[model samples]
Target: MEQTLRETIRNNPKKILGVNPNDAKVSLSYLTVAFVSLLIGGILGMLQGLERAGLIQLPSWLNYYQVLTAHGLLLLVVFTATFTIGYQYANLSHSFGGLLSKVRKLAWIGFALMLIGVVMVTVMIVLNEASVLYTFYPPLAAHPIFYIGLVFVVLGIWACCFGVFINYRYWRKNHPGQTTPILAFFAMGVFILWFFASIGVTIEVFTLIPWSMGLVETTNVMVGRTLFWWFGHTLVNIWYLVATSAWYVIVPKIIGGRHFSEKLIRLVIILLVILNIPGGFHHQIVDPGISQSVKFLHVFMSLSIAVPSLMTAFAMFFVLERTGRKLGGKGLLGWLKKLPWGDVRFLAPMIAMISFIPGGAGGIVNTSNQLNQVIHNTMWVVGHFHITVGVSVVLTFFGICYWLIPYLSKRQLTPKMNKIGVIQTYVWTVGMALMAGSMHIVGLLGDPRRTSDTTYGGHEIAVSWIPYEMVFAIGATLLLIGVIIQVYAVFNMMFFAPKGHTEFPVAEPEDDATPAPLWTERWGLWIVLLIAVISMAYVVPIVDMILNAPPGSPPIRTW
Candidate 1:
């Protein structure tokens, strides 16, 4: 009987057993770091908001720019990256029955390298030795160590990327004539984008290292800025793609319904992967040296991303509507009422999906050439980012947490904790609404971003911005409260939840639906196309920036 049980467990590891304890530990450790970073970054965000509103004066030992730099790095790079790795690895492990031992080792190595890099970067930020902000844009150089730390971060990401590749190759070789599992497919798309996205930034950083060390007198600012945005803007979509994975596969299961057409889903993923990198050009729309024709062509490339986005939106809606109607929901709008609104697992992501309506519209505005010029450097762009990332992406991540953490920890989410999560979601939504909303209004009034002070010696126009700034302070306070509650909930779920079996929540397709075609798995062809598209959009402008470059500037430390 014991031998029979062992064989059963081996045959159905994910179901009969659960996530391997070793594998669970790897994911949990990464998540712990992610949430901790969120806590610190949240505090810094609150400080920046209050200081910007003139509600408090910062001490000499710390400055607003320093806080800004740390906040961006902690939340954007550390928090997001760690969370993504943790979640994706969990998906990979569960979908493939279990991760290989070697893949597990690579994950641990990746974690250690990331920790070392984060420490180096954080220490520099705390000591005020590096305040160049998250973009690390050239001409405003940071400490050489800061740049070196970033190199480590990239290396860590690459290690994980290679681990995914090896595991994927092994899976395909072992199971020929079968399509990859859907969740695993999404994971591949994610790491593929991650690996390619880092390439430009990696090159830019290598150049900066020697320049920051004074081994070179100057470095090309345009090239550096372009490279950073190549990674930076694509980073936003990487988050979007991660969120969509949940929307596609996880949410349907939560609602007791099947997913949309597998073919359509794969097509969306393929389109996104092929067209994403070139979309970064819009970030550089206003910069010089790039010709108008190039910018015009890039505007189209930037807008092309919306096709996949719209495809995602449509697919999700179809699933929601179908599920609702099947559950006996009636009327044109009654299907909405059938959703599991009381479940935090559903509520958080529901709001996230809804928030994207306006968030996506805001994105279209930012991508338009003339429209971008109007709000390019204003608080409006900040507001747009907050709404899109804070609500759409982070909230989706929050939703995943309620289930994912419990699943990995071998615990069940209690009702009381669900209530707390629901409350946290609403609090975050309202806070972001107030904060991001006011920012948009004030930005249109000409309030600039990235400035420590916009008072302009109390000029009437500047004075007019004060009331909105105060709104920012209030919204920020609420957001901090939300952050604290969320951190508490994550830890509680991780270590203290009731011991029980929790489902991994993967959805299946309808019985009658067609299987996803094998052609969709042609990743090599997709990658070659990605390279071609990137070349078409970047080659002319980037070559112009490098070959006809201006006299490069020395490091200028503003703060």
Candidate 2:
């Protein structure tokens, strides 16, 4: 009787939606941390942007690199990751019918580990002992505790991943012949990718921790950089995975359209497994230590990544077109006019997709050794990153947060709040256009990235960069405003809003009657493919590094 009743409620689109509050303790805890991280990171980002603009000098107590480190860690690592895990937990809970009772211990323990790590790392950074910047590249070594803290955080998140996998494994056992729910399937695929991705950072952690403690005299720069990129690029890709899942699943419903082809979506997931790791070679395209043949192999692989992206574009745009037509759109291009402009839910993701066109193009260019010469370390790369992770992933996550949190907290998002959300997204898009556009142009004119010190000791070329930097600062101010608005809405809803229900935007596929292939649920096959591809891409390069490595360098303390 309970199972039959559950099936009835779960299948019904018209019924009240969202995960039960009792089932969302873990996600709520994570959302708290994630939102706070956004505030801290966003504020630091604004200061850094202003500093770069030369409008104001930084205070004596803090330097630009220190601020940069804090901003990157808080936004890129903490906010993006915590929010992804939180949302995925909520997603899995809804899919599994409720929180699996056995995983409660897993949730609390993982949260504890992450909290402790955050505190430790935050203290280290505040003391200015760990200003190595986010990448923590050696000989730019941070303190020992900072590295230890990073290990703790990664372990905590990995533990949560294990718990999710275990629960899903049990569910499959009990419910034979049933395919995993779509979100759950997406989560599992990402979980697999992240686990593989984690190996690189974990290896770095093991090496860095001991080295920081003086157990090792020197560390290999090539090895550290190679491992870092191995994890680094994939870390961003993990964010993409989380955001893309929502794009495929949630945005369609927001636009009043049915979901696109599950078969194609599944293929996209599979392609991610085969492509994401090997294609990370694009990150190291400018490094000369690796041979041209290896770089060429990765460039070819990098170009192949576009195939999956195009596939995604096709699937998403097709549904969007359908949604436009359903909303009374007509003609070949008329459907474009019919999209939900005022709704933040639809606008944010739509804007994200629009930004991705140029962002993805920049990525491909960076893969080319010759083309990368112009933009490799320039603000162009920064502009590209802002468009991809900054606008595309960041805005979409903001949109998800606006709705997802309200649903989980069982709080109604008032009409006023929704309007604010819409405004914030649009404001952000405009801000990014100004900042990123100028950044690209300035980069082509030879502006470097990663340093606040744009002045070349009164070099004539420095004068040319001032206007672009000023534009970036102005854009940053507007972007900060958007961040403030989002945080206000989210905090108000989570803590102080009246108790009320909100609908879960789970779009039923256009062809719900057609079953997804059984293999779509076979995560094991995807894992095998991922392993083979990673081995082919990494083993030779890593081995080459080990064989030809020079004596490693001693750690440097910038402070």
Candidate 3:
């Protein structure tokens, strides 16, 4: 009787109309927070660039590290976190027809908690009580309220994660024989990763709270750092997974092509989730306390992530070529000319994919023990993430905004708006290239990062870095322009654009594609495997750090 009712409700004509307006409010609210963060973060980023170029001096009330901390926190944490929640919830709503009312309430509750957290953290930063950079690595402590703010944020994320799980369970029970929509599957992967990846950081933050309150005298820096990166590097892959979802499901639709094998895509998601957390160990390669042999092992574990990445690259290229050929291109390379280069939907993510080539290569260098020694502490490291996250992940997010905002708002993507987006994409690409390229080169020339001034009394080598620093300022200026355009475009589309329908743009698989095995849906088995992998990678080193611990350091404020 319940099954029959579920089927009837699912097939109702009104259910297929569009996203539930109530659900759209949840997503749009999160997106609003996201773009607002982007605007502020972008401004902070430009200030850092100008300061690094020695073009402007900040007032006494604000220091370089404060700006750095705020910039990283806003864009990296708040912006990305809010955007992912907003976007993924929309995916869940679309895939399941509509979210459960309870789930919608959870979304709003999560939003409120996160907003509270962001407010607290921002206040601490403003008061200069927390300039602890985004990583918030320990011994360098912030006010206890900063850690408390982070707790609220994590709690908020947990709320959303539970909501997704509930929705997934409900859908599976209703449609026993069917695979969940590909986007929902991706959403499951995203929130699952989110829930688990945050565990280490939650533990870290709980420890920090007491020490920051002077309840504990000292905290172990090694343990704190280990815990942080366990979450930190996984956060990187979480964004990658989010971007990959679009590449696999949405981009193909935009390009008029079928998605690659469903089985392969699911396999990729599983592999990424299991292999991801261990890869964070590589970020700690330069730090001591971990044995050299373990670090060497972690190098391989980190590189293991590249296998699925390569598979994705291959699959995407295959889809693009096949689609272009179908659109009537004669020669081997001529298919490239047949793509929709003018479409912002395709153009932004295509460039994002292209940027990952260099980004991925740089990652390989960062992972290698010998190679990492040279650049680990340099601006090259910053440049690497700038291209990886800044372009690859962020540009994809920018592309998503064009269709998603309009769809949620029941508005059209006007030609004029599309042109603005296209120009914004180019401007951002050029800006990131100039800034990241110069950072990489100057890093190789031995320019250090996190230091406000490297002039060294105008030494010859330092003097040489001035030109590259100037380029950084110029790139930052253009990026600010891009940010202004993007934020303006988002609000305009959400509010003022003409009323019309927009498609969600999920691609279908090829006709002859093999059915994805039901075994892939065994999320329990996958989670077990993920835990096992994490244990193998972390247990030994963490045990060593705890057992052979030094008397830890007390809180110290550098600023």
Candidate 4:
């Protein structure tokens, strides 16, 4: 019976079809580092949350802002970016049969560079030499090593991207007229986005490296920020795209359904590529130096990208409904009850999807020029992201890890532990609900963000915010509990779980009525479009800032 099950899994069309077992271990090398960064970053984040609650005091040696910076860079940059690449390799293995020597070598190069950079930047943060926060915009420069380390990290990623493309190019040559495997398409979309998005940061960091090293005395703060946001806003969408790939490509099969439209999936990826770059300008709406026309353009463009998300929501419903009805479900929403809620794989992404609904609304609010002014930089902004990236993206990733860790490590995720994974998801969702919800309300109430002490003016309105803070503290504690369990489950799966095998499950997609278009494969055209849109939105602003910019501020490490 066990052999039959293994054979069935091996023969499944939608399953991760890949090469040697050794290739999987190579892919996991990157994932291992990512998990390590996530754990450390999560711990720092909990410390930050507790300090906010006044539950405990961090050592004077470890300042709040420094911890904040570490938390942001480690999780957002180190963990997410590395994880995306590793997962790309995993997905690639589904098509390539296994990684070639070049691919493996490049993967290791990327990993080494990233690990070294992370360690250097981390040490700098611990010594309080690089607390410019994650943005690190000048004239508040970081240590030279910090900026240089970032450059190494970016180069590492680019090498990995190069490796993926090489395999892709080779694959296309051999499989002419075949639609690229969906998993392969997913990887191309992700790395193409990364390739374009990294351009801005590459330039931004190069500029900072010189200044940090004292080669240039002054740097335009405006240009620096403009460059960073050009990179920053898209970074959020990159993570979104990564998580959504799993949702779109594998999710249907999870519920015993097929993709609704392969063509639609391709369109969604294309739209994200073209629309997401222009959307970055929305992040800079509040800056006095940026043009109103540009910000307005960004508002519409950013809002435009949200349409694909809406499409995803509907398609997901259709898949769920169809699958549930086939499984004997009935009524308007009864199919939802028929979902495999007990499986942590489904449960994690489900909670993430549910949480993103509110987060999406908050994004619209933030995009508005006038509306954003009302809550900009308040805890509302914090709450919004806590829901979006914090809850949605992070939860999805953790959920993926539940299956991924065991599959990659050849460890068994016991039935009992699967229940523990599900519990962790709910605990996180509930805690985020309380924490992020209160943040939105308090943000609207005008509580400032990124500050340690809340006391000010001593007015009644100011005093009223304390209860929410206490509630937030309670939520934070609950969230940390979930984090602990999630991390423990991961390490348990990696090192201590009984040896066993689990397949990388791929769900059946609903048969598409319309065939995927040939143009969807024309990645070059879309890449050109992406470049054009980004340049159109940013070129004038960046050039204008450089030609007639404000004086650069000198570096400061003030707490």
Candidate 5:
């Protein structure tokens, strides 16, 4: 069996690299990109925080538009994308059977493409030719290279998806009639969503890049916005879905229990894919071009997406509670007392969940048309997203890395440093919360977002909000320190961890008297495809309205 397996793996190099890909090389490469992106993004964030505090004079070269563009692109595209694909490669290798070589090579190709795209985009921005936000929204243009770079990035991501699909096929083939591994399925689901989501962005990149460079007469702003959100909304979901998988896997391990319900987990994955795509329309709520009915429908779908999110939270908490019980914890609050609080793995997830509460609440508020009007383009909006998306989800990613690095390297972390990192993660979470709260309050006071500094109606606003800005800067400093500690931990695990061969724990055999039907074979994906088509149909007319608004009529602005 071993020889057969080795031969099979050698025959298919892509699968081996994909299943048990070498982390020492690829993971570190991706991490290097993430580190640089985070540093740049963090600096920009600090600068924005200082500007909000009114502590420093703004510089001409530190243009708000350019900083904002770079910050968004680096964090959203570079940091999140690189970390996720890297994690997926690592997780899929361990979770799915053993390593397959062919899949790993495909992953390498994907990584190369990602690096190429990043370099291309970075050069354009440095040259002052592509200051357009990562959105690359139409009417506002950039060098054609920016769009080309993005295409290369997407192509690389698509190649990564292919690697994921091949492994899924192998798993199914080997483990006939077994329910797909939950984490593996979720990873594949993200890719499926991404594949469809990229269609719109692909269209924009191909059509608009040449047009923006004056190779064509013009491009439609309305069409571009519509397409971008199709990619944008799902893009966020791509990251969140991966974060959710981490939560599902790591939370159980932290609490010392198995998942609550595999079926429910599957349901959550399906629902996310279903609800996320249609809900992209909500981003257009402020635009006049979309019809009220269609907008309302999107709002409804967006609300529906929250259902799975809540369900996931429940699933996690319920499992944790059970684990606590099994470990001999006594009462309602006893589980809290019994948990291994000193374990960074345990503390990290706990902190992540806590941060999620305010973030999720803020998201619901921000997505509401009436509430969004009050905070739109304000510091509060920035705070809200950073907390929900940045702190909650990304922190969870950090937690997973902390937990997995030691295991993968066959070593234990510097416990003292790990503990410090956990504490810092908590501090950062609270700091983000405080920052978001202050921003929300100031937003209610009518402070705009993405501005280096602003004066309303030629009168400078009172500096009463200075305290919040100060608090935010302090938080940023602490957050940076915490991230640095984490990097230190990862490095130590890679270099100093015990050097020895270790075998993965074997899954116990289950007694199965009867064979099961294939879920994939039984359910045709046509229904899902139909839903996607309908979603696009719903969005097309909204674009028309935005593009053909009557002259002299102000663009529709919703609350």
Candidate 6:
């Protein structure tokens, strides 16, 4: 039966179309998506960046709204979805003992559907038919077909979710009572998060589509935003969680050490599942409709979410320290000096950690209701997320691909260029640091986020910060160049690298390692449920206020 199944998978045209087509097939797919998505998104990002710098003329017909919408939706859909698919394919093959033919067919179907959705949305935006800024906040409506395209995108994501679940079940059946691989468990958590997080979008599509088509009189923006954040905030965590898993698996190997505490790592994952979902209300800090009490409750929970993130920092640093000590390094800073400085593995995590520091701090400030007043909708906001998601997560993705591609393709990376890529990683990190720092300062000085130009406190500020803007532009260019270099290196390794058939040494199978306990399995699902409960607890009364408060309820101020 196993033989027949393997043969079928190997022979099926659609199932095998993209699989192992060459040494670089899997890596190239992921790199291609990242490159293209970043390219498109980056162009829009550059416009936004330049506008913030006050260096560009605002074109009236540019339709900033549509550009913003397309940029956000495309990046979210392509960057996360494509990277997840590629990583999971490699992860499943290793974790599940082997990949099945059926799973491959499902993945292909999912990829195709996602591509169609991207095309539909892109075309709509280009035609100026949809300008809803990715939020699709109703009453600010878009073409019905825009919503339909989103449906296709979600459908495609659902297919990928099912594929992951099936693969998990298959692995568990074959290796009963064994602990699940950490990477597989993390992927499963993300899929489960998607299953629940997508509910809000699903509701929007079903009800809002009809409403937009003129079948209903009104659509509630408040309800939509609430439901949307329930999905949105958790989706961000989903991206962070997957990227963190790469950190967990790769950090130890890169530093040449073992995980400091497996149980602690698992516990953090559990906490992430629990806290990440409920904390979406932090995004609504500035909205007046929500009560102060409810907002405060979210503030408290948002601060709590930081605990696990800190725990991850601790675990990672501890492991690196241990690895340094093992290599005969001395004190606190001594370990840093001994790291394999030139290796992509070491460079990736190091840069990710450095970028995350400021990003995390900025996140704290933005989530505070009072503090948000100062920086909300400012360039600082842009700087924060780019560091967190763009610099940190994207860089780590490259790191993992760098390590994995060589192994999967049975080829060694071109040595000299790989080192150069590592150096460029630092250059990019420094550039972002300078750019984000300048943006934060300017934001405090009262520059608005997402605007082409602004006057603050009834006066037009001189272009005193043009120099900083120039520096930021330089940084942005350098960052792009760095990314391009990494892509070129990966491309060469994947396609043109001479395939000297070398069987890399595989790790010894762990007999004692049982599949992760079932009670601990699907932890992310329970986390989603908990988040829903918390969000509803805080959000229900806020909804009541919008629905029942007389023409003017006494403005409640708790801060």
Give the C-alpha miss distance for residue 58 in model 2, angstroms. 1.1
Clashes of each: 0, 0, 0, 8, 26, 9
lDDT of 3 by residue, 1-559 (tens): 9887677676642355777899999999999999999999999999999999999998768888899999999999999999999999998888888899999999999999999999999999999999999999899999999999999999999999999999999989988988888899998899899899999999999999999999999999999999999999999999999999999999999999999999999999999988899888888888878889999999999999999999999998999999999999669788899999999999999999999999999999999987887897788988989999999999999999999999999999999999999999999999999999999999888899888888999799999999999999999999999999999999999999999999999899899988888888889999999999999999999999999999999999987
Compose the digit string of candidate 4's lDDT tens values, residues 338-420: 88999888888888888888998899889987798889889898899889988889888888887777877777779888999
TM-score for each prediction? 0.98, 0.96, 0.98, 0.94, 0.87, 0.86
Error of 2 at 559 (Å): 3.0
Candidate 5 lDDT, 1-559, residue by residue in tens: 9997897675544344432336435655666577668778767766666665666655665555666678788888888888887667666766664445788778788888988998898888776677677676666677778888888899988988888888888887877767665667777778777787788789867877677667676666666677788788788888889888867766676666666566666678777776676656667778866677667766777787789989988977776776788888897768767777777766776777777777777778877866778877777877777776677777877776664555456555566757766776776677676677777787777777766666444464645555666776676666666566666666666567565443322122113322223463322373365367546555467456555844322111111
Candidate 1 residue runs with Cα over 4 Å from true position: 1-8
Find the candidate with the highest TM-score and give its number.
1
Candidate 4 lDDT:
0.82
RMSD of each: 1.4, 2.0, 2.1, 3.1, 4.7, 5.7
With a 3 Å backbone cut-off (N, CA, C), the pairs that clash in candidate 2 are none
Cand. 6 Cα-lDDT: 0.69
475-538: candidate 1 lDDT, tens digit per residue? 9999999999999999999999999999999999999999999998889999999999989988
In terms of lDDT, the poorest run of 10 residues in model 3 is: 7-16
TM-score comparison, 2 vs 4, better candidate: 2
lDDT, candidate 6, at 378: 71
lDDT at 445, model 6: 68
Per-residue lDDT for 112 in model 4? 89
Each model's lDDT comes to 0.92, 0.84, 0.93, 0.82, 0.69, 0.69
Sort order, lDDT high to low: 3, 1, 2, 4, 5, 6
Cα RMSD for predicted model 6: 5.7
Clashes of 3: 0
User: How well does candidate 5 match the true structure in TM-score terms?
Assistant: 0.87
